[model samples]
Target: MRAQSSATGRTAKAVTPPHAPSSARPAGRGAGTGAGTALALSGVFCFSLTFPSTVWGLESFGPWSLVALRGVLAAAVAGAFLLMWRVPLPDRRHWAGLAVVGGGVVIGFPLLTTLALGTSSTAHAAVVVGLLPLTTALFAALRTGRRPSRPFWAAAVAGAAVVAAFTWQQSGGALSVGDLYLFGALLVCAAGYTEGGRLASRMPGWQVVGWALVLCLPVTVAGSAVALALEPVHWSAHGAVGLAWVAAGSTFLGLYVWYRGMAGIGVARASQLQLAQPLMTLAWSYGLLGEELTWAAPLAAAGVLICIAVTQRACD
Candidate 1:
């Protein structure tokens, strides 16, 4: 769970903003592992809330509009925080990394999730999104040249099978195209989380996220402008409420907490904590969307939890 080292005994190259410090090799392993696990659990809870809030927000706004507006608002909020704290701006080197991270997390992931949920049930989305840990682990291995143990891969494969079975049962044996897109979204978000974790360790969690959003403001604004130009947008009371909740709670607050957790923890252990998200999403979907929880729900939940436990033990 500690920051990974490359094969050459160097720090693994992280796709972080220029102002962010390079990954640090922990001086003591025990303390670092414990801190990482705690932070990762917090990140899991924050991420679990995203899907339910997205379902609420999408009741009114178009997917593109919802994502674009969320990014713009999130960036503004982050900017205000920076000004108040007098945090120094990131230098040019960090800007490129911020741009990539922001585009992946702020623009791409939200947009994809919103679009997929337009056609698929939130429960379906949850099951598919559970693969994020596997994706993050793959990215970590590729980036750090650290090979995971065989049991880790076995658990991941078993977890995917459980999710696949759940999805098939929920859909009555037919897979929706939206399911594929949602899985793609999970992969992209996983990469962002992994890269973001590396940067978070170097800067204050809020600063890392705030500055990245600020750096990506121009792109967000441009995207929002295009959506507005093409659509006759009317903000209803419900839409306004939804947007307010998503902007304040999901985008701003959720991301702040997630980055804080990542800053304290490394990416691999943090990814393990994401196993909780599918369960939370399933609960919210059943309550709010009136979705029926099939027998698959309990079975899939058990399997995913077991896989996470196995992976955690392997890491230990």
Candidate 2:
């Protein structure tokens, strides 16, 4: 659900140097920050809509079926963009990396998240996903051999504690197993983001994302076919609309903007903006799904935002 670059073609920020650390200040740092922040906030809003849409669509569709349709639709849209742009096909060396990232981001995250939301509330899913920045930071540190500042670690720990406390309170002493699955999905998403950021530094961000989707098209199509074969099809107007929104807004445009931002801002700091997602999602749940806004919502939102700010400031 990231910001779609306007059709009028804004200038892209130059990719960061490979030798630069993931947390290094970006070129055109101010502009990059503004653009990335805007895109990330937009993504949060767009992504917030996805859970409700998933819930709506799932009323008539199986979770895997919904996931499969999302992949196929998103891949088709992205493939069209590639063709329109005349983007060259990725080289053989990139195929494996693209497959892994596509599988994680396009297939794994959506499926697990939809499944998790089947049992958990959208608010619960949002709160769990707020931890993505922390997960991404941890992975970046491990991958780059760059130790995070003490403040970063402290913020991450504090954020996790807040999330745990909030989840426990919300669940009435029993932790929802679905929350665990969301956490796993976030971890996989973090890995994909980290690797994709590295790749974006070397290639055009659009190219990286575009080629990955192209490589993923066959797998996504086959998966969709299998799901269709297994499940009874009962497509409704509401379901069709939801699927289109998820495909266009969440998957295609979202990844495009996210990758573009990652190319300029690098993974760690860029990932911090993801903390806003849960807050945005909470707002969406209240407005769109008529979910009640409880005390925990504000507390969790503030805690995560503070953690993200602290960590990002420390990195800067």
Candidate 3:
């Protein structure tokens, strides 16, 4: 990611006259920073409710049906938006990346987590998913083919350590099979997020996700139909709403800003900010599910926040 962009920026500079004012320089720099910060936080906020939504949705739908239905519903919304805005379809060169994005984000993560949640408590799942930032950073490094510096690595590891320690404490120092599923989800989701971020650098963030959702339609639609045919769904109003939230908010719109932030900032830095997600998830659980708020919750948030701050500087 860094290599291609740096090369392109250099190539453009080489073509310009020495005395040119370079009007493009100042625009993306300052604005990009602010946009990245806002977008990253916004995306995390949208994602924080996924656990609750899944819990509610599973009351009516099986894990496979939930994922399939969510994908189809999200695809419809994304398709309408892309057509309304007249966003161009991705060219052949981008098809592979788009496929990767669809597979990981649209299919893999949701299916894996939903299945995991079937066997685990939401609280346990939330704590486990706090590892996402580290997974994302790892994938970002791989995608960019740029190794993080020693300080950057330290910050990243520290952030992950904080999450692991908190989760182990919360879950009684043991990890379940569900936790393994969530870990797998993190790996695939990281690849999706990193790839989508790279795509966002070249086009609008919404367009990238929109196109991905559309591309997912054939599989999503077919799978949903087959599942519904095989296993009857006992849908409820509350469950429908929960499914809608996951489909519209988590699958589609959340990605809009997530990729934007990753493009504006580097993927590593933006991913570090995801350290705050489990806390936000905890808050949602407390308010919505009547879950008890642990006294250490705030302390955990503070420690993770500090780690994220250190990571920001270290990465910079």
| lDDT of all predictions | 0.71, 0.74, 0.78
Where is model 2 more than 4 Å wrong at Cα?
1-31
| Location of the lowest summed lDDT over 10 successive residues in candidate 3 | 1-10
lDDT of 1 by residue, 157-246 (tens): 788788888877776788777887787787778777766766665555666678778877888799889887775666676577667767
Q: Would you list the rank order by TM-score, best first?
A: 3, 2, 1
Q: Which window of 10 residues has the lowest lDDT sum in candidate 1?
A: 20-29
Assess the local accuracy of residue 108 in candidate 1 as a C-alpha lDDT between 0 and 100: 76
Report the lDDT tens digits of candidate 2 across residue range 18-66.
Answer: 5632322322244466776665556566676778788777866788888
Question: TM-score of every model?
Answer: 0.83, 0.85, 0.86
- Residue-pair clashes per candidate, as listed? 2, 2, 1
Count clashing residue pairs in model 3: 1
The predicted structure with the larger lDDT, 1 or 3, is: 3
- Number of the predicted model whose lDDT against the real structure is largest: 3
